[model samples]
Target chain A: MASLIAWRLVAAPHPASLEDYPRPPAPAALRLTTLGDPRAGALFWMLWLQTFDDQAGVTASFKKMDFAHLTAWLERILALDPGSEYPLLMATRVYGAVLDPGRQRLMIDFVGRAFRDAPERRWQWQALAAVQARHGLGDRQLALTLVEELEQRVPARQLPFWVRGLHVIILREGNEIEAAKRLMELMARDGGLTERQRQAVEMWRERLEELR
Target chain B: MHHSRQHRGQAPSRLSAVAILAVLTLRMALRERLARAMALMIALCWAATWFLASLLVSDETGPQAAMLGFLLRLGSVFLTIVTVTFSLTRDLQNRGLEMMLALPYPRGVIWLGKGVGFSLIASLLAILDVLALLPLAPPGQALLWGVAINAELWLMATLAMLLSLALRQAPLALTMTVALYLLGRSMHSLLLIARQSAEIAAEHWSAVVAQQLLTVISWLLPDLERFTVTDWLLHHGGSLTALAPILTETALYLALLIAVGHLELRRRAF
Candidate 1:
């Protein structure tokens, strides 16, 4: 059984894109290392799984694992300790769609579920989910709904400016250039826009001008 | 007559006698195979904690916060239980306990000394756990829980001594000790559950009876929950004051267990 599991990990077909892989499988009990405390348990199991094949002759079976398995492992860890920040942060920083789309969406999906399971930094995570929704999965409606939920959940100041900018970008991509320009102009009214964010908003307004 | 040191020249002071037993118990633990395995296990657990901490994106000390506390509470408890129980049983089986009882010292002093000696092994492990977690946990909290785990182990050791005396076999004594520790830790919640169910059923008599039984048991058994603040210490830095109740209850339990063992020894034919 161990050999078969190892074989599956090594020979699993590469997902052509982020959309290719299905949702991760449920975790088996043997994989759990929880001893009552969730956060500590989650971190411990994640590290142990990462280093499972670190013996002298082992081929490092952990690296060859596909996103499906990785997500399953991560899902189990998150289930054990939903409040931990490791799942969202590690998924974003380590797994990106640019490198492997399948792995990227796996993390994005993980983060989206984590957004509901653990609401520690819900707005920030949902905003990241919005970016992934439009760019990674090509679901503009999902992106819009995520941004909407993000706006409602947090204070106005806490919402990232880039999240608002993504709203304009999503609007432009949806063929609502006029609405996008109006939103961009509304953002221009904000006194707190950093110098770089203000430059991005000006670029958006300029592009809308060219469209006119 | 042979057991009486008073006839020869002078009797050993109570302090020296206990000191001798303490050294003997420490030597027994040093010679025990389980102590070595326990050392390796503690090191491995810490290594795993260090690795887990490294995987965090921000490399914060938060992930490592519970490292030593968990080791002290869960891991060291089991190791100490096995070591203390097995040593006691070995002494009994080999007739070594008989020879010790034949000595001039009372069984109370001997058992207390042995408990103290067995507790040192746990103290050493707790220290190692603290040093491993030194970089991860706040120093004050680490030291506080370190002392807490030691006191907890001493309490457990005395309990093991009493269990071995009562059962006269290591395997059964160890099993019973483990069960008692688990039940003690969860006793508050279990009693609450029982009483809540009784209330739901409208069985006033059952609730009253359960409360009376729990009160009696509480008087005899230390509430193991007092030692279970690993989560509090992990999430919020703990202060020395946190140990007050735990230490008090642990000392009380230790004293009771020794007193009981001393009485049990007096009644025995040996």
Candidate 2:
């Protein structure tokens, strides 16, 4: 027993990424039937995903994951319980922080697609995805496109005016002076902005006039 | 006239026999160190959940409580199966079971007595689970989860006892009980799948027949889909009124399993 313990302490194992592991295809109906509760099934797989550390350690870093498989799993889990915010949270906050631009875009796109399905419950993730597009990926065009969709698609009353006015700010940053001025005028005319938002809009319109 | 009077006299004797046998079963489980084993399991489960909770990046209370509830439920089911099956198998091996059956008391006295004993053991396991889960979940939700889990474990215990009496071997009874428990837990999903398939392909006879067969199996098996729900402990949304169907199903299944076990015992020649 002493020799075995000494040997175990001396030996080292090879480090492996989470990509080395095989991802199971978890269909929603089968999981719901087998586990009998969607929340329980979703929680089990969510916990299982944390077990794949490259080293013999406590938690796996999202940087080491295969984004394709991770996106597929997040999709399947969201199908099981659409109301669950954990999957979306992981997409935007955890996996979105990876250094790889391609993987970051994949996470952003997954969040975007999920938002389209339940915009009322998930607009914040979409907003974060737009921010990632602009700042992280250095793609202002994609950010402008996403922010425009949010403005047009989501119900106005469900979100605050600041969220709704994000497209104008993006357009202004992109130097679309005429379009930004038009959107702010339309927003002010619509009579939905709060007093503070209206004041900010007026100040921004004056700034845009000088830039033009 | 004499047989009828003897039947009347047997009632009180049978009651006393049941009480005596129940006490004996509890003693046997105590000798098997059930409480110590269950306590160890509860501690291990609590530690594991606490470690998992620490790994979460977001607010961890709800998911942690859900995971703890799930692990405790699984542990209780496994312990109940092992204790009930192995204890009965030991009694059968030592001829104690046959000796009891040879007496004038009806076989049900022996069956109910042992069933009630195992139910007590199940209650003990549930109580340990509740205490372990108390700090993680709300007290009301935790208590409800404990009662629901106790009902689930009691159903499993009665089923395990029936399987042991019928199969007469430790390994066989244990295997059959686990298989049946898995089947019962997943049967609801199978029925739903079959129904969907039938609707999609109404002209296909295979789908229709499969639906019919699963319907029969669902009827014969205990519907365990709602047993020990984690949502109750997580405060997602469940009330005390929701336990009515689970309790009713458990009582019905327990009575049926005990009756069938008694009939099986009567048919044995020993």
Candidate 3:
């Protein structure tokens, strides 16, 4: 229990960053049912891992973890509670196994549905997908598509104002300026913008014209 | 130099009387024959949990942490029941309850004071458990758990008192209280599970009857599950979204239990 608390304190600050060790294999031997509370189901997995770690130590057990186990565990957790954000977020962080594109794309697709369901979470996850598409997989087209989707999702109020005009922010970080401009226009029309936001939008439009 | 001046010359109001009762109840818990034994048992249980945790070969603490949490909650529930039942039964068996009723305070106030006192003892005990596990729980969650356990105990204490008043025997009252508690906690989950097979529910008249009975019982009973956010301690991000509603519901239920218990007490011949 003490160790778990320590891990949570450590994990909260660094989103998606886990300790450098392999994750344990899925507990396929345990005949579990999602018919009860999903939280309880997730707990079963946690306990299963802890049992493995007891003798080997946590680092050793986590080191034994493979990508397949992580993906499978997450998929099951999501199935049990699709709206549960923990599994999706935890899995999203680790899907890219050091620039290998295949697993990352598969995870992005898996989490995309959950991200869409959770509107507030859309920006961060879409940004992640965009990064995985661009640098990790070298699929610029898929990266561009994710950025466009992110642009549609972001409320103008949330994005920092002048930053996008001078430099592209989260959604358009890959120099997808045109998509950012279109999203800005939509926010401006939506019309709850602060004075700073409106000015930022006008400046961004001017900057867009100059760049074009 | 009047003794009344210590309390500002006011006749001890119902609140003061209740306060005295509560303090006395706490003292009574300590003085009870089982108090030391129970404390020792709890100590043994915690040591066992720690030992069991050590036995698990995994380095990841999540699994053992979960087990500890489950055991903590289950132990608390049992402890609350035992403490409430024992305290109330002793009071009834001895002449102490009659003495309290003989005092100038309203009968309802006496009942309320006893209930509050029982809950206070349970809360203190639960807090001790929390402190034992405090290093394991996160900053906000330990306090959240304290709130949850208090609410659950308050409800259970109210139930125990009600049963004690309605049935004079300790064993019978305790048996009924446990039955009611289990029914309260499981009723909703059972209904949800049964409803999944609507065709089965429809085909079997007995199933529909049981479902309806469960629905009624749940509506009347405290849902103990609402107070269990044990995972929030483990960074599961559980919300206290229903906190206000749960508090409101508990107050209403306690009020209802007191009214019925008071009426039952009144009907008894001295």
- Give the better candidate number (1 or 3) by TM-score: 1
Best by DockQ: 2
Flag the better candidate by TM-score, 1 or 2: 2
lDDT, residue A132, candidate 3: 69
Once fitted onto the true fold, the runs of candidate 3 whose alpha carbons sit more than 4 angstroms away are: A1-212, B1-11, B33-38, B41-45, B51-65, B201-205, B239-242
What would the per-residue lDDT of candidate 2 be over residues A6-26, giving only the tens digit for each residue? 998888864543344356553
Model number with the top TM-score? 2
RMSD of 3: 10.7
DockQ of each: 0.13, 0.44, 0.06
CAPRI-style grade of the A/B interface in model 2: acceptable
Off by over 4 Å in 1: A1-35, A43-79, A87-120, A159-161, A175-212, B1-20, B31-38, B46-75, B102-106, B135-141, B181-256
The CAPRI category of model 1 is incorrect
Task: Give the TM-scores of the predictions, in the order they appear.
Answer: 0.67, 0.82, 0.57
Worst 10 residues of 1 chain B by lDDT: B228-237
After TM-score superposition, what is the CA distance of residue B13 in candidate 3 from its true location, in Å?
Answer: 3.2
Candidate 3 structure quality by residue, lDDT tens digits, B135-209: 666646666666776777778877888888778788898889888876676654566655544455665877767
